[model samples]
Target: MTTRTIALVFHRLRPNAIALARDVAAWAQQSGCKVVCDESDVDAIAQGGHSHLTASSSFRDADLLVSVGGDGTMLRAVHSLNGTLVPVMGVNVGLLGYLTNVEPEMALGALDQWLRGTEGTSFHYDDRMMLRVSIQNGSTKQSWLALNEVVLEKQQSGHTVRLGVDIDGTHFVTYSADGLIIATPTGSTAYALSARGPVLSPRLNALLMTPVSPHMMFDRSLVLDPREEVIVEVMGQRPVEIAIDGVAVHTLLAGDRVSVLAATERARLLRFNDNRFHQILRSKFGLADR
Candidate 1:
């Protein structure tokens, strides 16, 4: 029999999550399928006597990678995959289950369907767009990926930031606000939504420029075509912190320019026929129809 392979990633490997991973692993192994996980997760699981897992250093060639956590875990899994385009399945253990496919109780069944190829036949995939951010500080340039959004915020507390925003090399606006958020369509419901940015369809190939608590009149979010690259320059001799996907990664000194563009690759997300984006929004956020 041919050995099918599946990779597992965990959020924190709590008992419940560990049990789910083990259950999924055991089931896959029953049919001579290969179960692998990154060394980090393997070490975590080894402490609990589930060390029969293959310690993989990468997600390349994974038949399917399961993330038994929340949206953050899903994002991390995708980031680790690093443009490999591997299909990711998420089990929700966080507050917002936006990126997760199923709950912990449903994880085993979900994996069973995929492994058997019968119940999983109808499951589809959505290629969610991601952002490629490049920051230039003098001759040094650093690039990063953000599955959600990229924010340029002031380093000093209680002090606002000034960013000169441009689109496709044309001057647009200078934002006098707490910070600025450049969000992908998949991120519309995240930080952007709370800052009054309009919600975009998940399938839309677009980006949003939303100012965070602007003191000037041009405060409305601007929706731009996916082809356009956004440029934000740190102004006013003040340094700003750069946040990618909610974590502060670096601080941009004055005279730095950050460019954000749609990545050539997209995140392949696993979605079952039973799961729908609209339904999740209503269930998670209590969005009732009038």
Candidate 2:
């Protein structure tokens, strides 16, 4: 296996993550590997006399990025690595590290194994879909890439979000709900799960649409082939909020239409060869072993 330059990416200065970052950095240096850290991490580790870089510079030349945080931090790191095919490995720090596998204490061991090209060689790599969100009349949306779901929510007080769901210009549902969620199978475990949508296996090739607090009784979740194009129009209140992966992209007016679908580009995440999706599910949801 070829040895690649690895960057140790951590969350913004949190006490818990600091220790893990220190350990990972120390190990990287001792192993004669290059360690890349953010501005704050660089400051913290400067006391230990270890050299590091800002998040901006970390990904510029590194082959791989090791993320130290929960799923949120991992997503942040992935977003920062936009357009680059750098593989990311998440180390679970905070709660709900669904995207992350290795814990703090186990991070060093995992890294050692990865460096030796034995830990994650057998792990399956999954390509995730990204959504491109465009507001009818605004600058490019800031949060166009979502690892989980794209949400169209109501922003005005006491008003509902009336949207017409269309697939390839064909009408699907006209919903009066607090918001609507368009998610992918990889995002099935995220907000889509909380909205009572089906948990699609990560390997499935489909998209999920779930209504959030819909006033109409006929509104139900719809599963469509990955090729279908989803369009949502803001129809009710004067202003509606559009959130992509938990970040607000823009507020739309009554006439604005938001279009979402699978992007040609894909986000690549590194996995431990020994990891299994079913095992993660059983452990996370407390399902009994069969």
Candidate 3:
């Protein structure tokens, strides 16, 4: 059999995350598998006393990518993969890890099941939809992949930005609001939820568009088909900020436009169980049985 390559991605600032990575690295090495990590994480891994593992700038070829932090680290790992289909296994070391499927103590056992095959275990792959966002600003054009939601919000405080909405090449409506969110079904439980957007099942292939604090009367969120393309253009003098997965990336001026669509590529998550979405949700929010 060929030696498998496992890539470890972790939260550098979290001691528990680093410790988990070190343990996994040691186990992978002993199991005759190659262990790798992002080149930027080399120093941190070394400080954690696991310098023998390989450092890779890209994880496109990795058989599996292990995320040793919370949902944020898992998102970062997915971003680092850059649309590669490498399956990610998230071990939660942070609080409210909605994206993580396993805890630190059970991480190694989960890896064992994955490596040894799924014949006797409940191992499986959970595919989640993602969004592709493109921006056109005069002569500059850029695009990004978002596992969560894409946000176009006001750059300055106490100012509402004007944005024109279009769907499938047709003008829809214009709104003056604090911001707009274009979220995948997987993201409906994230930032969109806090904004009063309805929760969507992760298995659905749809988009959730919600406007934050809209000054207009039509403040309800819209559930759209994944095949439909939604565009938002800046219509006011004040510049707007574009954020992907909650990180502000660019500033859009008046007349600039952004297009959002379901990505051709999906995020593959490694799973040891099935149909736990509702259970996890209830546990995360401490919902009452009554």
Candidate 4:
């Protein structure tokens, strides 16, 4: 008998995702694998009833952590891992799942290959980024780590503001626009793409700076090397909002400076050899499979 421990994490808010988690857990258990999961998942399925599930708010030890949801849930799982070296596998519950790609039907088959040591493997480590954020009239002290992009925009629509972007203490440009987006390669396909930013390959070491509805069409997107540090200084008297990885929101005032740079940590996403980055991209974006 083979012994492998796996952590099954999922978004409890979605019924389909929860059901899929239960299925994966049940199958792993019957196949002689240990499954650490949340109680809600176990309770949802009769086969997973009375499972040795860990509490939702607590930690469980496992060799692999499985996330069942879309990209949002994957980010939550990354935070939950909290620097653990354990790799995470995503089972996309819905369409347009940028992070979650493995379909529900393919999950068990993939798991079988993974446990049998017959699967190909790759590393899709997270590119952590740093953020220097401040509130209006506040000290330049608030900072953050972002796995995706950071967005600065007007709190209310139909308003324009002046934003100065500086790179390494030099003036890059000033934009009179609705907002700006600073995204990592991993985040290029997200809100940044919707704002007209180019899609960056995941392995590329670069940052994408895109302006949202700039007053000047000349304010096209800018791609910078990963080593560069960016600072966004507000230049007008208007209420602005900052969103980090779509998880936290902060208010910024004119004269406040938001700095962004690469972070020290990396998010480890377990990848099997069968998983192809370009393939996933083409499938999601409807590009030619070739």
Candidate 5:
């Protein structure tokens, strides 16, 4: 099957990355491929002087999606995809390119590998785990998918929030902390790591739950089985906010509950042969094998 269509999703605020997105589009068109540019990015693509971009581009219809920015941009791209089967290729234009497949200078080469189906030899699909967060306040309910983590933070400033937790319906400890983070294996390296959570290999299918500055002695991070579900209920007088992948999605009232679990869906990331998780991890943290 030929990959005749490619979608380019970029972070609009990054000028240099926007320029690279346009160049990528132009290059795709030159290779007898159709370029799918998100309407929101149309203006950014225009900045790179592309006048022949294909019209009516949809993330659902593209054979592949390229994210041009940092990990955040890749997360945004993942969000836009809405858990579609469309594999995303992340091109790094910012620092600590954990999710991005290639550096800015290597963008074209990465594209070539994708176009040529250079799996194992140069490119492959690295399926990353995803998270689902559902917040219910009385009769109102909403859900959000996260490539990284779901955070519940205290909004009752000057005072710590009370969070009652349960794992698989068993009563866990009530955490008195500023916030809580429930991250997927893919997110283990992110906020969870900073909060002293253990680093799980990306290939492992697990979930990491870490409390943010809890006031109790039971402040250790919890690594749960993939099938286990986490339920956190707000017990404070004020409110707590639910942050999905760093973006505030909902406000949790005193009685509101947040249910987090491994989503039935997974995120597919483009990876080249030389880009294994351990190598990237070492490089990102400036570790020395010597």
Candidate 6:
């Protein structure tokens, strides 16, 4: 029998999350499986003399990567994977765990089932689409991946930044607004939803563009084909801040441009059951069946 490897990725600040990771590590060791953690989180998970856990800079070889926090932690795990095909299991320790598959109490059971294979257990992979974003400033260029939306907003408060939009190399419109959000179907329920953007099925292959507090009357979101590429150019004098998956990463000056499109790689989430999207949405929002 071949040895299996399980990687634990958790929110370092949460003591409960850390404790749960340690428990999972101990369980994996007892089950004759290798337990590892990201190098950045090794110290935290190795605390209290839990020295058996291995520290790995890469999780490409891990059979499974378990996220022991909320949706944000899951997003962090996906970003850390960097397009690796490793399957991620999410155990919710925070509120609103839309991305998580199970609760903390069921984590070990779920892991056991996953280890046992699908012969007698109900386990599957839920692949979700991701987005790739590129920024160009003169000769310097940078790129990042986002499981959620990529935001380009005004850098300074009380000022609206002007951004020019283009689709497939054709100029679209120029907007004076607080920001613009380019989101994948998986991100429809996130910040885009808060901005009044339409909710799309996570299984759909599409992109959503929503404007934030636009000065113009055309403020509705535009859902575009996944194959289409969107370009947002910085217009006027004010600089704009760029955020990937809600984390601020770069600042673009006037004349800089950002390109967004569906990534070729998808995030593989481990799931035990086939839960419908509308059902999950209704449960998440406490929507009553009238």
lDDT of 4 by residue, 156-255 (tens): 7789988998998899789999999998888888888889888887777777899999998667889998788888998999977888778656788878
Model 3 ranges off by over 4 Å: 119-121, 138-140
lDDT: which is higher, 3 or 4?
Answer: 3
Residues 29-122, model 5: lDDT tens digits: 7887888777766767876678777655458888888899999999988888888878899888888877886888988888887787656776
TM-score for all models, in order of appearance: 0.93, 0.89, 0.97, 0.83, 0.95, 0.97
Clash pairs for candidate 1: none
Q: lDDT of each model, Cα atoms only?
A: 0.84, 0.76, 0.91, 0.75, 0.85, 0.90
**For residues 1-290, what per-residue lDDT tens digits would candidate 2 score against the true structure?**
44457776677667677677777777877887777766555787556566553334547577678888788888877777764777788898888677887778878877777677643364546677766565556665433767788888888667777898889889888898888899878788888888888888877777899998889987678988888889888776567888877878788888788878776667778776555778888888888758
Model 4 clash pairs are: 120-273, 121-273
The 10 consecutive residues of candidate 3 with the worst lDDT sum are 117-126
Instruction: For candidate 3, write residues 95-208 as lDDT tens digits.
Output: 998889899999998899899876335588888999999987668779999999999999899999999999999998998999999999889988999999998989999999
- Residue-pair clashes per prediction, in order, are 0, 2, 0, 2, 0, 0
Candidate 5 lDDT score at position 95 = 86
Candidate 6 C-alpha lDDT tens digits along 224-263: 9999999999998998999999899998898998999899
* lDDT tens digits by residue: candidate 1, 1-290: 56778888887746777767777777777767788998777766666566568998888888888888778888888888888888899988777878886888877777777766653475777889999999876688899888889999888878888999889999998999999999999999899999999988788999888999999988899999989999999887778999988888888877789999999988888877565667778888898779
How many pairs of residues in model 5 come into backbone collision?
0
Candidate 3 TM-score over all chains jointly: 0.97
Per-residue lDDT for 204 in model 6? 96
Model 2, position 168: C-alpha lDDT score: 86
Off by over 4 Å in 6: 119-121
lDDT of 1 at 141: 84
